[model samples]
Structure formats: C-alpha cells, structure tokens
Target: MPYSSLPPSAFWKLCRNDRDFLLSDIYQPKFSLTPGMRIATAGSCFAQNIGRYVRASELELVDTEPAPALMPAETAQRFGYGLFSARYGNIYTARQLRQLLEDAVGDRLHDCTLWQRDGRFYDGLRPNTEPEGLGSEDELRAHRLDHLRRVRAIFDTADVFVFTLGLTETWTDTDTGVVFPTAPGVIAGQFDPDRHAFLNLGMGETLEDLSAAITLIRELAPEIRILLTVSPVPLTATASGHHVLRATTYSKSVLRAVAEEVAALDPGIDYFPSYEIITGTPFGARNYKDNLRNVTTEGVQRVMSVFFGAHDGLAPVDRPDTGLARPSSDPDEEDAVVCEEAMLEALAPK
Candidate 1:
C-alpha cells in the first residue's frame, strides 16, 4: 500500500483506461526540430507522409530535387520528384539506403540492377520512380547520376535526417546480392528465380546494415542528427511463405529492435515510436483503414501530432481529435502515406 511499492513508469496503474496511457510521450528527443532546419527524410514509403505534413507546418522541409518550376503536382509525385530529399523511392531496407549513399560518394556502381520492359529500361532500385520506363538505358543512367549528386548534397547540408524502416524481407540478385524494393516483375523487371534470390534478414543483419548506414551518414555529415521510425503498416505480401500476419510481426520486431541498438550508439540518433503509436494495443488499431494495412489520414495526423508534441516545445500529451485532417479510403490522396509494398497485393493474380 506504500508509495515505495512500485518502480518507475508504473503510473499506468493510475489510468482507469488504455487511451490515457497510450498518449504519453514515449519519445523525448535528444535533438530539436525548429523552423528552417533542413530535415531530409528517406526509408519506407510511410516516410513520404513527413514531407507533406512538415511542409504544412512551420518546419523547413528541404527538397533537394525539386520539380521543374512549373511541373504539375500529380506529375511531379509520379516520377519520384518532390517525394523525399531526392528522387529515390521507397528505400525498403537499410542496405539499400546505405548503398545509395555509398554509390553517390564513391561511385561504387550497381548499374546492373536494372530492368527492361517493352524496350525501355528502369532502375531496379527505383522501378516505379519513372511511371513509364526511361527513353533508353543511357537515360536511366543519366537520371540516376544526377539523383546521386543531389543525394550527396542533401547529406552534406541537412540539419536532420529522418528514415522509416519498412521491412526485413527483400529480393536480391543471387550473383551480386544487391537488394530490390519490389520483386523484379511486379513493377518492371522479369522475376527469375535463377538470377534473383529472396532474403529474409534477421536482427543481426538488419542491425549491421543500419549501423553502416548511420556510420556513413555521420561520417559525411557530422552535425546531422538522425531520426528513425519503424513503419506500422503490415506487409502486403511475403516471400518467406509465412502468413502475412506472422511475417508482419517478425519484420516489425526485427526492425524495431535493430533501431534501438543503432540509436544507442550515438546521442544524436533516435527512434520514434510511430510504429508503436498505431500498432500499440492501447490505440486499439483505430489508426488503420478497412484494409487494415493502409494507415488513414487521421492516423498520420495522430502520429505526427505526437511527433510535434515531443519535439519543438509543443504540448506533448493532449489527444483532442482535432479535425486537423480528413480521413480517406484512397491511398492516392495528396498527403496520403505512400507505401509501395501495397502493390504486392495488386500484383497478385486474380
């Protein structure tokens, strides 16, 4: 009965219900994000939400690869323009992200990771960036080169970098072990079992890959702070042959753990609980659309509100359901979360 009976964080016992507990600020960031800070985001498709949301706020979200001055908004988004700091689309794994920067700085080319469709070539790394295929193999190469140069510039100048970890399962080239965001044929490449292999990364490999990514980013931009979040959206399909439900659990668990390990390495690195905010039991899955995989607009606002609260000296724990945004059944909506992994289902044979 005495106050000495329990340890820290046990205050949840005081809550008569779960919602009160879920709103607590699990994130106390080591770095502050203020207006004019150049925050470049990457990683899973869920990350795309940050750019849209931050632009609507006071923070200075940088777009290193801005669309041509008069480019249409819809057109700009489709060609992988104005999405992240660069044109790189949905970097699903840490190795893919690390290798991207590696290629940018050292010119360690992985050019063979390309796909051909109807006489046009696509960057296997970002097959969907170009809605159609590039005019020629040379065109693909030229665009990729320019993208890399901007990526390097982004890394060198950003005050903060945010990345969302999406999955642990990936398809890679058997000979070279290069990772692909989607299976080859799904978007543009031919899926060949002989040439391509499936890899379901474990905690150790994910940890190592992320460690390398953090190290490389810090080495290039010593003052840049890193923020990492695991996407809460479930996997659309699994090559691991496990039920998507089980696969989702494993994938998220590995990423969440590895993120913590990486964050412990540096004071500037942090892991935000966007994944937990939506997936946590207390929220009761209120954040998902009917499909249960696509996070709703309300959910994105909810997550970002919590994000703003913990950083930038904003109020941290108020859960007023402000109609700050509207919900959508459509993933194509502007400011919608862009999760290319969802394409796996649309690719399934009817």
Candidate 2:
C-alpha cells in the first residue's frame, strides 16, 4: 500500500528503464543557489574538479589567496596557489579539515610537526603544497601563518562551504594526534613507527570530526550554508592490510554513510550524490578513464550538470574550455588530481 502511494522515482525499474535514466529526480536541493553567492570549496583531490566547474558557472568560487600576477598558471598550480579556495592542499580526511579550522581560529589544538628531507623542511600538515619544501623551519612557519590568515578570511566571507569527504584512513602524530594529509614518508617525512601511526576512522569518529568542524564554521560565519559530497574516486592505496579492492569499498561505504547521516540532521546542510552518479550501476564504471581510477572529463561534466540543474532558475552548467594543455596519454598524466595518496602505489613491491 505504501509503495503505491509513492512517486515513480521510488521504484528502481521506473527510473532505470527510462531512456535518459532520469537523474533529474534524484537530487532535490534543500536550498536554492544564486549566481551571487560566494562559495568556498575545500576537501580531497576530487574537490578540485568541483571547484573548477563551479568557477566556470555563473556562481562565484571564492579565492581568498590567489596566485601572483606574474606567475604562470602551471607554476602557480605546482606550488599549490590556486587549488581549493586557499592553498590548503588535498585535505583528505575530516580530522585534517577540523584541525585546519582549529589552527585558523587560534585554538592551537595541535601543533603540526615539521617534516624534513635533505636540508629542506615541509609543513607536516600540507607536504604536497610545497614540493621542494621550504629552506628552513622558520620560513615554513611564516608561510603557514599567512595561509591561516587567508583561511580565516574565507570563513568570514563565504556564503556556502562545499566539502568533499575523501577518505576515512589517515596518519596522525602519536604525540599530538594531529592528522596529516598524507602518510609519513609518502611525500617528505621519514616514517617512524613509534611516532607516526595509521588510523582508519570509524563511522562515529568521522561524524564527530565533521560535526565539530561545522560548529566552528557556523561560529565564524553564522549564516553560511554547507554542502557535502563524497568523492567518487577510489582509494589509490591502502595501509589497512586488506586487499585494496575491499579497502576501497569499505572506505567509500563508511564515508557515504557518514555524509548521509550528517546532512539529514541539519536543515542548513545538504549532501550531493556525485559519488552515486559516477559509481552507481547506471554508468557501469564508464565514468572512469582507461586506468579505472581517474574520472573522465565526461564523467565530471555529468555530475556538475545535475548539480546546477537542481537550482530552479539556473541552466545546467556547461563544462568550460579552460584551454589548459592536456598531459601525455600516460594514465598518470590524464588529469591534474593532485592526490598524495597516489604516491603510495610506488611503494608497492615492484
């Protein structure tokens, strides 16, 4: 009886058998977006794609810390200048995001360790952002201070905050419990079993970190709306000791569930199903490119099309021609998803 009263979308076959597969009915946005809204984006590597597409649309993607006028676009990107609202590179875990917010507001919850390689020192929290590492610890600290100031400005100005949940697995400093974006030794730091530890966050821990982060965000900007997404990209490698396939499935399942639970609890927060659009059976994994990891241009376009279409008066966002040069056909060169997790693959026994 209940089934009969529900809409056609409630039935799998009704939507699945349709010619276009009818994605329009899937996401009814909790709130409408206007072109004038200043949106701030931060999260994993996949979040970069969302930010790019948003910049292409009529909506404004807030860039608090932009590249210098003289720096080339490619060079700016390499030094982590133009990615994700601020240059906070690849925040791959909810805990890392929470710590960044705390540091920004002067909570000083965790004193980030400085990772060193050769004579250079890297910010343990964002090692990939400075590929060559800074010349000294003092210089790295100065850069971090300026970075946090810009991050605070974003919180003060943004209308909507978009975060993509990337992974449940993280590496943390044993002494301070500060989470790092990448595992130690993956990018710059030497792995020390006694000091650095791997953590796979459970459902409760993930929920708590995000909820706390939201509380801090609302404190800073009382009216800011939040949009959450789970990245469709699979894990590049797993330290969990399970087969990578099982590890990927587990990580994604936990993250997707966490996003759903968190979004349901708050009227101001919304979850977008970009993860389902790419990974669901309807696409049959065709959304992934030849390597079966990186999402293709067509895949990202489809996800963004549905997102912009959900807003009542706005036309679907067309993927803009950024005119950036494409890399060679090597699977590695396909897209500029600056994923530090991908570096783990190299450590696998050759």
Candidate 3:
C-alpha cells in the first residue's frame, strides 16, 4: 500500500525508527537579560514565575504597585502584586486585557461613572472601607477616578510589558461590554441577561484584540516592548461545556495560536514559546515540581535556554551608566538566602 493510503497505525509503525524526527526541532536557546531593565509582568500565576526568577538573578524588575512596609506575601495579598500579581486584576483572557487598555486610553470607554472624595477617586464598583457604612455614590465615584489615574501612570512608566496570555473565554457586561475578572456567579454578583454576556474568542478575535492593546501601549509609551507567552499551568476549572481536562486542552490551544499570530504581525512584539518548552514531551514524564500543576526549575531552565540561545553571540547588555558597581558575589549569594527566608516568612499564616 502507498504511504499516503496507509492506516494511522501503519504510518506510526513505519516512522518509529526516526530518532531525530521529534527531537530535531526541540532546541533550547540562551537569553541575556540586562540589569536595570524595567519589566512589568501580568497574566496567570505561571507568569509570576518570570518575576521571581528574574529578580532572583539580581536584575532590576519593575513592580508598579510596590508595597511600602509589608513583607513579600503581605504586600502581594494586600496590594494585589507580586508572585501572583493581580495588577490589572485577573486578566484571564486577551479580550479582558484589551478592553482594559482600551478603557485606559479613552477608547471604548464604558459608561461606568467615577467620582472623587477626600483627595481620592474611586470607581462605583470598588467601595471604600471605612468605619462608616458603604460610601455614598459620589464618594465611590471619586475613588474610581483616582484608581484610573493610577493605572494610567503604570502604563506610562513601564518599559517592557511581559504579558502571559491565559484563557480565551470570558464573562462581560452585556449592556456596557465591561469584562469582569471572574464569572458573575463566582464573584459576589449576578449576570442578568440584560446586563451581562459571555465571550469565547476565536483565534482571529484574540489576535485582533491583542494587536489593539499593543498599539495602545505603544501610543502611551512608544519605547515599551511586549513579550508574550502562553501560560502552561492547566485550568483549575472551565466554564465551557466540556470536561475540565478537555477544556484545558481547548483553552491552551487557542491561546497559543493567538500568541504566535500576534508575534508574526509585529516586530516589537516577541513570542516566548514557554508553553511548548514545559509541556512538550522532551521534558519527559516527570512533573517539574511537587506541585505538578506548576512548572519546575528544570522546566524554567529549558525555557530560558531557548531565550538565551535565540539571542546568542550578541554582546552582553552593558550595565546602566549609573556608577553602582555590581553587588559582591558572596554578598549577593547571602542576600538571596535572606530573601528566600523573607519570602517564606512573609508566606507564613498571618
């Protein structure tokens, strides 16, 4: 029988001896990151790993919502930044993120009203926590206006926006078209048909929205480059009708495709194939960590290998002209140990 007409089993058997068939394409590259580069990270929990690994290397990692006095974990929980930074608040889908940027840029502005009080602005949705009961409508509006201004400031200052595309499905306000961080029921809210709707973006729609976001970011800060990745961590749950396992596959496939599409369309935008590096068979059957859901150090190393290799042979980025000498090697090691201890302490039950 001709190869083209052979059944699937026969085809597999014939190619069984091709040792280089799958392995040939799995190359890991080296990445050279400069010190003092201001990079902001957002997306799912897996994306947070980049911040941890980068900061651990003693490079300058930017956190827009830096906590004042709280320890690492407390700062993360209170201000919603770090390790699991929710800087923009649960941007699980590209549509939600795009909508956020659009709103920030004064395009596709939602009807949501904002007001100011006591020198602070608040969105109508986010309430003020004080000894008194819920704040008056005027007070809530003020807080929201202030929040919007702060969010804009973040966009203005960031040099690199490292966005990890997570999911393709989202729940949005039907009338206002405002995308919610979570589904209506999961959070303290109801989704009336007249006011809410669900969106499951296809590959094209995802790319379109992401492209718009990139354009908007450049308008705000033209120097800002975008590094896009697909989160490898599987979904905890899916609103899709399929079983959780199948939904994970569906969601990841869609998001990965979108990342590639957008990267191809723009030069400043780069796609780091972190998803393939971690989940691909080359890593073998072992889970990266004790928490199998999270990618392990070995997995991360593999991703970085490609990152470095891709920029191979280029001169190392020069240290910023600031007269600060590199921190001493021995002291740096000790600081890492201390930081790790502090991380653990911060995470202790409070």
Candidate 4:
C-alpha cells in the first residue's frame, strides 16, 4: 500500500516501460543554469564533452588559457587549449583535483614535478599540454606558474563549477604523495618503481578528496555551485594486478558513490547522471562506439539533451532543433578528445 503512493520514477518496472528513460522528469535541476552564469569545467576527458555542449549553448564557458588569436583551432586543441576552462590536462583523480586547488593557493608546493625527455622538459602535472615538451625546466616552470594564476582566477569568477570524476587509481610520488596526471614515463618522465607508487583509492578516500576539493572551491568562490558527474569512459589501462574489466568497475563504483555522497551533503552541490546515460544496463550500451569504450556522438547528444532540458528547459529526447549545435560531419572539425590516459596503450607489448 505504501509503495503504491510512490511516483513512476520510484519503480523499476515503471521506468523500464517509459518510452524514453532520459525524460526531463528523471532530472529536476536544483537550480537553473542561465546564460548569464559563468561556468568552468574540469576533470577527465569526458568532461571535455560537457564543456563542448556548454559552449554550444547560450551558457558562458570560461576560458583562462586561451590560445593566440592566430592559432588554428586544431593546433590549439593539440596544444591542450580550449579543451576545458584551463589547460590543466585530464585531471583523472579526485586527489589530483584537490592537489591542484591547493597548489593554486600555494598551500602545497611540489618539487620534482618536472620531467625531461629527448632533451626537453615537461611539467609532470600536465605533460600532455606541451606534447613536445618545453626547451628547459625554467620555461616549463614559468608556464606552469602562469597556469596556476589562471586556475586561481577561474574559480574566482566562475558561477558554476563542473567536475567529472574519472578514476580512483592514480600514480603518486612515494616521497611527497603528490599525484601525477599520468604515470610518469607514459608521458615523459622515466618510471622508477621505487620513486613512484600506484594508489587505488577506496570509497572513503575518494569521498574525502572530493569533499575537500569542493570545500576549496567554495572558499575561493564563495557563491559557486558545484556540479559533479562520473566519467563513463572505461579506463584505458589498469596498473592494478586485477583484470582491466574488474578494475574499471571498482574505480567507477568508488567515484560514483563519492559523487552521490558529496552531492547529498551540500545544497550547493548536485550530481548529474551522465555516467548512467552512457553506461547503464537499461540502454544496452547503445551509446558506445565500435570500440565499446569511446562514447558515440549520439550518446553525448543525449547526455547534453538531458542536461539542457533540466537546466534550460529544452526537450530531452529527439531534440532536432535544440539550442545545442549538431556534431560536425568531419571528424577533424568535431575534434577527438585529447586523453593523456590513453597514452598508456603504447606500453602494451605487441
């Protein structure tokens, strides 16, 4: 009798029978995201997709490290500009996100975060930003210092902050516990098992790190609203001894639970089900590409449709004329996500 009073959304059979599961009724925005709001996005590669939709819509997506006016769009993307609000490439872990905010405010100064390869230097924190590396350690540090200033500035001006949780497994310096975006050697530095350690964060640690990152975000931007989502893209490779499939599940589980817990604790924070839209069993994985790892354009469109529908009151399904732009036919113009984590695929022995 008590269960009969619940809405259709509360019953699995009712939701399963709906024509489109991603209906606007599924998500009611806690607060509307108007065109006037300044939004900043960061996190794993999937977050790049979120930034793209935000830009396509009337919403203002902040960009602090913009490429030069003359730079070609493709070239700018290759050099890690215009991917997100800042050039902080692929922040793949909650710990890394928290560390970045701390570094922005000079609370934590990490030494030995520089990598050298082929006679050029790279900032280990964001090795992929400069694919060829900088001329010297000084040049790299100067760029990184400037980036920190911009990162701090983004938070100061942002009205809404969107972060996508990507992975629980991260690599950290054994001595300082400072996290690197990628395994050192995979991008630039030489890997030393003794100096570097692989950490698989549990639910407790993931929750703590994300909570702290949110706390820092609010401290810097007192009125900022935080939106959290888990990256639905499967891990490219797993350093853990367990099979990759198992590892991916474990990583996502921890990240998803942390997002839910954090969102529940604060009215300023909200969780978007982008993860479910792409990976949920109900969809039968229709959103993934042939590789079954990369999300298809249609999948991304659906996610954005739901997002815009909730935030901007657009139609959630079959949105032919929504404010969001359609994906370009040319793959080059559409632009593939620049994922440093995918670099690990090179290490696999043929």
Among these predicted structures, which one has the highest TM-score? 2
- Writing each residue's lDDT as its tens digit, candidate 4 over 138-205 gives 88888888898899999878999999999999999999999999988887898889899999999999
- lDDT (0 to 1) per candidate: 0.80, 0.86, 0.56, 0.84
Off by over 4 Å in 1: 1-10, 15-19, 313-335
Q: How many clashing residue pairs appear in each of the predictions shown?
A: 0, 0, 19, 0
Tell me the TM-score of model 3: 0.68
lDDT for each residue of candidate 2 in 127-154, tens digit (9 for 90 to 100): 8889999998888888888888889899
Clashing pairs in 1: none
Tens-digit per-residue lDDT, 1-350, candidate 1 = 87678643355655325544646556778787776677889988888887776666666677888989887766677778777888888998887887787888886557557678899988888887886988888788888888888888897678889999999999989888788888888888898989888999999898888888888888889988999999887898998998889999999999999988888888999888899888977677788877777787678878888798777644333332322255454643433444567778786768
- Summing lDDT over every window of 10 consecutive residues in candidate 4, give the lowest-scoring window: 315-324
Cα lDDT, model 2, residue 15: 81
**Rank order by TM-score, top first?**
2, 4, 1, 3
Positional deviation of 145 in candidate 1, in angstroms? 1.1
Scored by lDDT, model 3 comes in at: 0.56
The C-alpha stretches of model 4 lying farther than 4 A from their native spots are 107-109, 313-335
- In candidate 2, how many Å is residue 193 off? 0.9
